[model samples]
Target: MDDESWALSPNARKPLPELIEDKIRALITNGTFRAGDRLPTEPELAQKMAVARSSLRTALQRLQLQGVVEVMRGRGWYVRSTDVAERDEPLRFDRRVSDSDLLEVRIALETTAASLAALRASQGELDDIAKLAKLHQAASVNDKDELLRTDEDFHAAVVRASHNELLDQLYRSLVPQLRSYRRNSYSSAEVHVRSANDHNQVSWFLRRRDEAGARAAMTTHLLGLYNDLAAQTGMPVEERAGLTNYALEDEPSWQQNR
Candidate 1:
């Protein structure tokens, strides 16, 4: 493969890791790499692609998550599959599933996960959750990628703390789509601050083992995002009216005992 030829475009708006992912995927599509082929070592690929090793690792991880590649311990990354139709499945799913649909799924899964985490998380798990939450809160508002990465980490930590392997797997499956949604949805510093605050609130509840409070906080966080996405997409008022109704009727009860 001609690594230099895969260099990212100067005008691209996607994050460096995502751009690198695209380049690697293009390599696969063009038959430069094939199933079971060992990719160049991380250092070589990083230098050739003009990306940091960390960014390259991130791209490789995302590809692994999408079933396009895999990493062999002490060996190197390898192309796991090169079926164009199979690789495009996620993109097709994304196009069919709207942001609101994703958020609704998140609300269901994460709220329950948060509740379980509050009840089941060990001291060490709780500490990890708190640490990730703090990292997210302290992330620079000017750095969207940092904010997004931290945000994803915090949520994943909470899900892991739930100690439910099945839930963790399901959440991991949505990660690539969630990453894309977060990238496009972070429109301002205010939104970042709001998210950080919500995370803090959720962390606090988890620390106290307050299941209801944790569930409520996660629900509120996701619903707020849902409302924002609905507005941005110009969703019909009738369709959006339920969001307002749910918040008005249920959110306060959750917070009242917090």
Candidate 2:
């Protein structure tokens, strides 16, 4: 298909990148693009969509994050999968799993990853995690995109530092859903600052090779998120009680604040 056939409307209610993402998915659904099909070059896509190359790149990145498409180094973007709808099935918020349920799984995966990272992460990985932590901590509340990106990067770096390929892969698989969860969860500047501080605490423990401290820090970080989500979702008292029963030496600061 030619680039002309992919032109998007000039007037769009949604963000340009989001509209472009939907259009691409529609094309894929209609069989215009399939697995292994190379998408047009960025310039071509930009021209056809009447958007800047940056916007086109943003849409493509979001698709890549969702596992619908992937970019090959020095090549072009290609359709990675056509089963986009099914890809997010298991973690679909409120449908397949509650938001709290997702965080519960994250708590399990990330706390252990943090502990392993403290023991196994090399100096270079530890430095990267520290750098990302600082960046996320310094992100401006006014810039939600940067804040979100930095937050995701910090966590991913921590997971990567685990040096466990399977653990990293599992965390990567949850990126899209977690990204969605984060978008809805960042309700205030206070929340952002608290999260950034949590990242710093995680990095601090990892740098010192404090396995127990790293695990506890990660637990505190995610438990704050879990509590917030539970409150907002009106999670059942019994369910909330079950999920919040983690053993710790001291009360989490967030809980103390409340």
Best by lDDT: 1
TM-score of each: 0.66, 0.65
In candidate 2, what are the lDDT values of residues 134-219, reduced to their tens digit?
Answer: 88888888777778877876787788779886776577667666677787677799999999999999999999999988988998
Q: What are the RMSDs of all candidates, in order?
A: 7.6, 6.6
Each prediction's total of clashing residue pairs, residues at least 3 apart in sequence or on different chains, is 0, 0
- Model 1 Cα lDDT, one tens digit per residue, 1-258: 555686886655799888888888988998999999999999999889988998998888777666678655457889978964555434345256766777777777898899999999999879878887888889988877788877877887788789886786577667777677787778888998899999999999999999878988998898888778878889876676333225445332321111
For candidate 1, the 10 contiguous residues with the lowest summed lDDT are 249-258
In model 2, state the lDDT of residue 203. 93
lDDT, model 2: 0.78
Model 2, stretches more than 4 Å misplaced? 1-95, 241-258
